[model samples]
Target: SQKIEQNSEALNIQEGKTATLTCNYTNYSPAYLQWYRQDPGRGPVFLLLIRENEKEKRKERLKVTFDTTLKQSLFHITASQPADSATYLCAPDPNSGYALNFGKGTSLLVTP
Candidate 1:
Protein backbone atom coordinates (compact mmCIF):
# COMPACT_ATOMS: atom_id res chain seq x y z
CA SER A 1 0.00 0.00 0.00
CA GLN A 2 1.09 3.55 -0.66
CA LYS A 3 2.13 5.46 2.43
CA ILE A 4 2.92 9.04 3.38
CA GLU A 5 5.26 10.00 6.18
CA GLN A 6 5.23 13.33 7.95
CA ASN A 7 7.09 14.32 11.04
CA SER A 8 4.96 13.05 13.92
CA GLU A 9 6.73 15.48 16.24
CA ALA A 10 5.42 18.98 16.65
CA LEU A 11 7.58 21.60 14.94
CA ASN A 12 8.14 24.68 17.04
CA ILE A 13 9.39 27.91 15.55
CA GLN A 14 9.68 31.52 16.55
CA GLU A 15 7.43 34.09 15.05
CA GLY A 16 8.85 35.91 12.04
CA LYS A 17 10.96 32.88 11.22
CA THR A 18 10.60 30.35 8.49
CA ALA A 19 9.00 27.00 9.24
CA THR A 20 9.80 24.10 6.98
CA LEU A 21 7.80 20.87 7.06
CA THR A 22 8.43 17.65 5.21
CA CYS A 23 6.33 14.91 3.62
CA ASN A 24 7.71 11.65 2.27
CA TYR A 25 5.97 8.81 0.51
CA THR A 26 6.57 5.29 -0.69
CA ASN A 27 4.98 2.64 -2.96
CA TYR A 28 3.43 5.31 -5.16
CA SER A 29 4.36 7.98 -7.59
CA PRO A 30 1.94 10.83 -7.71
CA ALA A 31 1.52 13.36 -10.43
CA TYR A 32 0.56 16.06 -7.99
CA LEU A 33 0.92 16.84 -4.33
CA GLN A 34 -1.64 18.78 -2.31
CA TRP A 35 -1.13 20.61 0.94
CA TYR A 36 -3.79 21.51 3.51
CA ARG A 37 -3.97 23.31 6.79
CA GLN A 38 -6.25 21.99 9.54
CA ASP A 39 -7.25 23.72 12.71
CA PRO A 40 -8.44 21.97 15.79
CA GLY A 41 -12.17 21.75 15.07
CA ARG A 42 -12.29 22.50 11.38
CA GLY A 43 -11.61 20.47 8.29
CA PRO A 44 -8.44 20.97 6.32
CA VAL A 45 -8.24 24.02 4.09
CA PHE A 46 -6.53 23.86 0.74
CA LEU A 47 -3.23 25.67 0.61
CA LEU A 48 -1.32 24.78 -2.52
CA LEU A 49 -0.78 22.13 -5.15
CA ILE A 50 2.48 21.29 -6.86
CA ARG A 51 2.74 19.12 -9.91
CA GLU A 52 5.49 16.61 -10.43
CA ASN A 53 6.90 18.59 -13.30
CA GLU A 54 7.17 21.67 -11.14
CA LYS A 55 10.12 21.96 -8.84
CA GLU A 56 8.77 24.75 -6.67
CA LYS A 57 5.65 26.84 -6.06
CA ARG A 58 4.76 29.77 -3.87
CA LYS A 59 1.78 31.77 -2.72
CA GLU A 60 2.26 34.75 -0.44
CA ARG A 61 4.38 33.60 2.49
CA LEU A 62 4.05 29.93 1.68
CA LYS A 63 6.19 27.85 -0.63
CA VAL A 64 6.28 24.19 -1.66
CA THR A 65 8.84 22.10 -3.39
CA PHE A 66 8.54 18.68 -4.98
CA ASP A 67 11.50 16.37 -5.57
CA THR A 68 10.51 13.34 -7.58
CA THR A 69 13.88 11.68 -7.23
CA LEU A 70 13.70 11.87 -3.47
CA LYS A 71 10.03 11.01 -3.39
CA GLN A 72 9.60 13.86 -0.97
CA SER A 73 7.97 17.27 -0.69
CA LEU A 74 8.80 20.22 1.48
CA PHE A 75 6.39 22.89 2.67
CA HIS A 76 7.70 26.21 3.88
CA ILE A 77 6.12 29.13 5.68
CA THR A 78 8.18 32.30 5.67
CA ALA A 79 8.05 34.91 8.35
CA SER A 80 5.60 32.73 10.19
CA GLN A 81 3.32 33.99 12.90
CA PRO A 82 1.53 32.56 15.88
CA ALA A 83 -1.67 32.38 13.89
CA ASP A 84 0.05 30.12 11.41
CA SER A 85 0.08 27.30 13.93
CA ALA A 86 -1.89 24.31 12.71
CA THR A 87 -1.74 20.74 11.53
CA TYR A 88 -0.57 20.43 7.92
CA LEU A 89 -1.63 17.46 5.84
CA CYS A 90 -0.08 16.27 2.61
CA ALA A 91 -1.95 14.36 -0.08
CA PRO A 92 -0.22 12.67 -2.97
CA ASP A 93 -2.44 12.00 -5.95
CA PRO A 94 -1.36 9.11 -8.11
CA ASN A 95 -3.32 10.64 -10.97
CA SER A 96 -6.05 8.14 -10.10
CA GLY A 97 -8.68 10.73 -11.01
CA TYR A 98 -9.78 10.59 -7.39
CA ALA A 99 -6.81 10.95 -5.14
CA LEU A 100 -7.89 10.74 -1.53
CA ASN A 101 -4.85 9.44 0.29
CA PHE A 102 -3.60 11.77 3.04
CA GLY A 103 -1.03 11.47 5.74
CA LYS A 104 -1.70 11.95 9.43
CA GLY A 105 -0.10 15.40 9.13
CA THR A 106 2.55 17.30 11.04
CA SER A 107 1.79 19.83 13.73
CA LEU A 108 3.39 23.27 13.65
CA LEU A 109 3.47 25.73 16.53
CA VAL A 110 4.64 29.25 15.86
CA THR A 111 5.55 31.10 19.02
CA PRO A 112 5.93 34.74 19.89
Candidate 2:
Protein backbone atom coordinates (compact mmCIF):
# COMPACT_ATOMS: atom_id res chain seq x y z
CA SER A 1 0.00 0.00 0.00
CA GLN A 2 2.44 2.59 -1.23
CA LYS A 3 1.33 5.94 -2.54
CA ILE A 4 3.42 8.48 -4.43
CA GLU A 5 2.17 11.92 -5.32
CA GLN A 6 3.88 14.55 -7.41
CA ASN A 7 2.52 17.76 -8.85
CA SER A 8 0.16 16.58 -11.52
CA GLU A 9 0.03 20.08 -12.96
CA ALA A 10 2.92 21.37 -14.99
CA LEU A 11 5.33 23.57 -13.07
CA ASN A 12 5.82 26.77 -15.03
CA ILE A 13 8.86 28.88 -14.18
CA GLN A 14 11.19 31.41 -15.67
CA GLU A 15 14.58 30.35 -16.90
CA GLY A 16 17.45 30.60 -14.40
CA LYS A 17 15.16 30.01 -11.43
CA THR A 18 15.28 26.97 -9.21
CA ALA A 19 12.38 24.57 -9.23
CA THR A 20 11.45 22.37 -6.32
CA LEU A 21 9.17 19.38 -6.58
CA THR A 22 7.76 17.14 -3.90
CA CYS A 23 7.04 13.46 -3.70
CA ASN A 24 5.09 11.96 -0.85
CA TYR A 25 4.37 8.39 -0.02
CA THR A 26 2.86 6.18 2.63
CA ASN A 27 2.67 2.52 3.69
CA TYR A 28 5.90 1.58 2.00
CA SER A 29 8.81 -0.13 3.69
CA PRO A 30 11.30 1.45 1.39
CA ALA A 31 15.04 0.89 1.62
CA TYR A 32 15.89 3.46 -1.04
CA LEU A 33 14.43 6.30 -3.03
CA GLN A 34 15.34 7.56 -6.46
CA TRP A 35 14.57 10.48 -8.78
CA TYR A 36 14.22 10.42 -12.53
CA ARG A 37 13.70 12.90 -15.34
CA GLN A 38 11.52 12.09 -18.31
CA ASP A 39 10.96 14.05 -21.46
CA PRO A 40 7.66 13.85 -23.24
CA GLY A 41 7.31 10.58 -25.13
CA ARG A 42 10.58 9.34 -23.61
CA GLY A 43 11.49 6.93 -20.88
CA PRO A 44 12.58 8.21 -17.52
CA VAL A 45 16.31 8.70 -16.97
CA PHE A 46 17.65 8.12 -13.50
CA LEU A 47 18.99 11.21 -11.77
CA LEU A 48 19.60 10.53 -8.10
CA LEU A 49 19.39 7.54 -5.81
CA ILE A 50 19.35 7.73 -2.03
CA ARG A 51 19.22 4.90 0.40
CA GLU A 52 16.86 5.00 3.33
CA ASN A 53 19.85 5.74 5.50
CA GLU A 54 20.85 8.71 3.38
CA LYS A 55 19.80 12.25 4.07
CA GLU A 56 20.85 13.98 0.88
CA LYS A 57 22.45 13.47 -2.52
CA ARG A 58 23.34 15.65 -5.46
CA LYS A 59 24.42 15.44 -9.09
CA GLU A 60 25.36 18.32 -11.32
CA ARG A 61 22.49 20.81 -11.23
CA LEU A 62 20.14 18.54 -9.33
CA LYS A 63 19.80 17.88 -5.63
CA VAL A 64 17.65 15.38 -3.78
CA THR A 65 16.84 14.84 -0.16
CA PHE A 66 15.15 11.84 1.34
CA ASP A 67 13.52 11.76 4.75
CA THR A 68 12.34 8.32 5.74
CA THR A 69 10.89 9.79 8.88
CA LEU A 70 8.56 11.84 6.71
CA LYS A 71 8.29 9.27 3.94
CA GLN A 72 8.99 12.01 1.45
CA SER A 73 11.59 13.17 -1.05
CA LEU A 74 12.29 16.60 -2.43
CA PHE A 75 13.90 17.21 -5.81
CA HIS A 76 15.54 20.46 -6.82
CA ILE A 77 17.00 21.85 -10.01
CA THR A 78 19.03 25.05 -9.88
CA ALA A 79 19.60 27.61 -12.59
CA SER A 80 17.17 25.70 -14.68
CA GLN A 81 16.67 26.42 -18.36
CA PRO A 82 14.01 25.78 -20.96
CA ALA A 83 15.93 22.62 -21.78
CA ASP A 84 15.20 21.44 -18.28
CA SER A 85 11.50 21.23 -18.97
CA ALA A 86 10.43 17.65 -18.43
CA THR A 87 8.51 15.33 -16.18
CA TYR A 88 10.16 14.20 -12.98
CA LEU A 89 9.38 10.93 -11.24
CA CYS A 90 10.22 9.48 -7.83
CA ALA A 91 10.09 5.79 -7.12
CA PRO A 92 11.06 3.73 -4.11
CA ASP A 93 13.38 0.77 -4.13
CA PRO A 94 12.87 -1.60 -1.25
CA ASN A 95 16.48 -2.90 -1.46
CA SER A 96 15.68 -5.96 -3.43
CA GLY A 97 17.19 -4.71 -6.68
CA TYR A 98 13.65 -4.79 -7.91
CA ALA A 99 12.30 -2.16 -10.21
CA LEU A 100 10.74 0.86 -8.63
CA ASN A 101 7.08 1.40 -9.12
CA PHE A 102 6.77 4.96 -10.42
CA GLY A 103 4.01 7.48 -10.14
CA LYS A 104 2.94 9.84 -12.82
CA GLY A 105 5.76 12.35 -13.04
CA THR A 106 5.55 16.07 -12.29
CA SER A 107 5.87 18.14 -15.41
CA LEU A 108 8.12 21.19 -15.45
CA LEU A 109 8.00 23.94 -18.05
CA VAL A 110 10.71 26.57 -18.10
CA THR A 111 10.06 29.78 -20.02
CA PRO A 112 12.91 31.67 -21.52
Candidate 3:
Protein backbone atom coordinates (compact mmCIF):
# COMPACT_ATOMS: atom_id res chain seq x y z
CA SER A 1 0.00 0.00 0.00
CA GLN A 2 1.05 3.61 -0.59
CA LYS A 3 1.51 6.09 2.23
CA ILE A 4 1.99 9.83 2.34
CA GLU A 5 3.30 11.76 5.32
CA GLN A 6 3.65 15.41 6.30
CA ASN A 7 4.58 17.22 9.46
CA SER A 8 1.71 17.00 11.92
CA GLU A 9 2.93 19.94 13.99
CA ALA A 10 2.29 23.53 13.09
CA LEU A 11 5.09 25.67 11.67
CA ASN A 12 5.70 29.18 12.91
CA ILE A 13 7.54 31.78 10.86
CA GLN A 14 8.11 35.45 11.02
CA GLU A 15 6.44 37.57 8.43
CA GLY A 16 8.42 38.09 5.21
CA LYS A 17 10.41 34.90 5.59
CA THR A 18 10.30 31.84 3.43
CA ALA A 19 8.46 28.74 4.63
CA THR A 20 9.48 25.30 3.53
CA LEU A 21 7.24 22.22 3.82
CA THR A 22 7.84 18.63 2.95
CA CYS A 23 5.92 15.56 1.80
CA ASN A 24 7.11 11.99 1.70
CA TYR A 25 5.60 8.89 0.23
CA THR A 26 6.33 5.23 -0.01
CA ASN A 27 5.22 2.16 -1.96
CA TYR A 28 3.85 4.17 -4.86
CA SER A 29 5.13 5.79 -7.99
CA PRO A 30 2.86 8.62 -8.92
CA ALA A 31 2.78 10.40 -12.24
CA TYR A 32 2.53 13.80 -10.58
CA LEU A 33 2.29 15.62 -7.28
CA GLN A 34 0.13 18.59 -6.35
CA TRP A 35 0.26 21.16 -3.56
CA TYR A 36 -2.76 22.98 -2.16
CA ARG A 37 -3.39 25.68 0.41
CA GLN A 38 -6.45 25.62 2.67
CA ASP A 39 -7.53 28.43 4.89
CA PRO A 40 -9.74 28.01 7.93
CA GLY A 41 -13.28 26.94 7.04
CA ARG A 42 -12.51 26.95 3.32
CA GLY A 43 -11.65 24.39 0.74
CA PRO A 44 -8.13 23.93 -0.49
CA VAL A 45 -6.88 26.05 -3.35
CA PHE A 46 -4.43 24.55 -5.82
CA LEU A 47 -1.00 25.99 -5.53
CA LEU A 48 1.30 24.01 -7.78
CA LEU A 49 1.93 20.69 -9.44
CA ILE A 50 5.04 18.91 -10.66
CA ARG A 51 5.26 15.89 -12.85
CA GLU A 52 7.48 12.91 -12.21
CA ASN A 53 9.91 14.04 -14.89
CA GLU A 54 9.97 17.65 -13.76
CA LYS A 55 12.72 18.70 -11.37
CA GLU A 56 11.15 21.91 -10.19
CA LYS A 57 8.26 24.31 -10.76
CA ARG A 58 7.47 27.83 -9.63
CA LYS A 59 4.69 30.40 -9.63
CA GLU A 60 5.14 33.89 -8.27
CA ARG A 61 6.25 33.45 -4.64
CA LEU A 62 5.58 29.71 -4.58
CA LYS A 63 7.86 26.88 -5.66
CA VAL A 64 7.58 23.10 -5.73
CA THR A 65 10.04 20.33 -6.36
CA PHE A 66 9.40 16.67 -7.06
CA ASP A 67 11.99 13.92 -6.73
CA THR A 68 10.63 10.66 -8.01
CA THR A 69 13.76 8.82 -7.07
CA LEU A 70 13.51 9.92 -3.46
CA LYS A 71 9.74 9.56 -3.34
CA GLN A 72 9.44 13.01 -1.85
CA SER A 73 8.34 16.56 -2.68
CA LEU A 74 9.13 19.95 -1.27
CA PHE A 75 6.96 23.06 -1.18
CA HIS A 76 8.28 26.57 -0.60
CA ILE A 77 6.73 29.95 -0.08
CA THR A 78 9.01 32.96 -0.44
CA ALA A 79 8.56 36.26 1.32
CA SER A 80 5.59 34.76 3.06
CA GLN A 81 3.08 37.06 4.66
CA PRO A 82 0.54 36.73 7.44
CA ALA A 83 -2.04 36.08 4.80
CA ASP A 84 0.00 33.12 3.68
CA SER A 85 -0.73 31.37 6.94
CA ALA A 86 -2.70 28.25 6.18
CA THR A 87 -2.59 24.51 6.09
CA TYR A 88 -0.74 23.09 3.13
CA LEU A 89 -1.41 19.67 1.67
CA CYS A 90 0.34 17.45 -0.85
CA ALA A 91 -1.50 14.93 -2.96
CA PRO A 92 -0.03 12.50 -5.43
CA ASP A 93 -2.05 11.29 -8.38
CA PRO A 94 -2.50 7.59 -7.75
CA ASN A 95 -3.15 7.01 -11.47
CA SER A 96 -5.02 3.89 -10.41
CA GLY A 97 -8.26 5.81 -10.05
CA TYR A 98 -9.85 9.19 -10.56
CA ALA A 99 -9.67 10.15 -6.89
CA LEU A 100 -6.61 11.74 -5.34
CA ASN A 101 -5.08 10.63 -2.06
CA PHE A 102 -3.88 13.54 0.04
CA GLY A 103 -1.33 13.44 2.78
CA LYS A 104 -1.94 14.89 6.18
CA GLY A 105 -1.37 18.64 5.90
CA THR A 106 1.01 20.93 7.76
CA SER A 107 -0.25 24.15 9.24
CA LEU A 108 1.74 27.36 8.86
CA LEU A 109 1.50 30.47 10.98
CA VAL A 110 3.15 33.75 10.02
CA THR A 111 3.35 36.49 12.59
CA PRO A 112 4.37 40.13 12.34
Query: In model 1, what are the clashing residue pairs, if there are any?
Result: none
Q: Global CA lDDT of candidate 1, please?
A: 0.95
Clashes per prediction? 0, 0, 0
Name the regions of candidate 1 deviating beyond 4 angstroms.
97-99
- Candidate 2's C-alpha runs over 4 A off are 95-99
In lDDT terms, how accurate is model 2?
0.87
Write the residue-wise lDDT of candidate 1 on 1-112 in tens digits. Answer: 8899999999999999999999999987888999999999999999999999999999999999999899999999999999999999999987566758899999999999
TM-score of predicted model 1? 0.97
TM-score of each: 0.97, 0.92, 0.96
lDDT of each: 0.95, 0.87, 0.93
Better of 1 and 2 by lDDT: 1
Clashes of 1: 0
What is candidate 2's lDDT per residue for 15-108, written digit by digit as tens?
Answer: 9999999998887778888888898788899888988887988889998999988888999999999999999999987446666688788999
lDDT of 3 by residue, 1-112 (tens): 8899998899999999999999999987899999999999999998888999899999999999999888899999999999999999999988798879899899999999
The Cα RMSD of model 3 versus the native structure comes to 0.8
**Superposition error at 79 for model 2 (Å):** 0.5
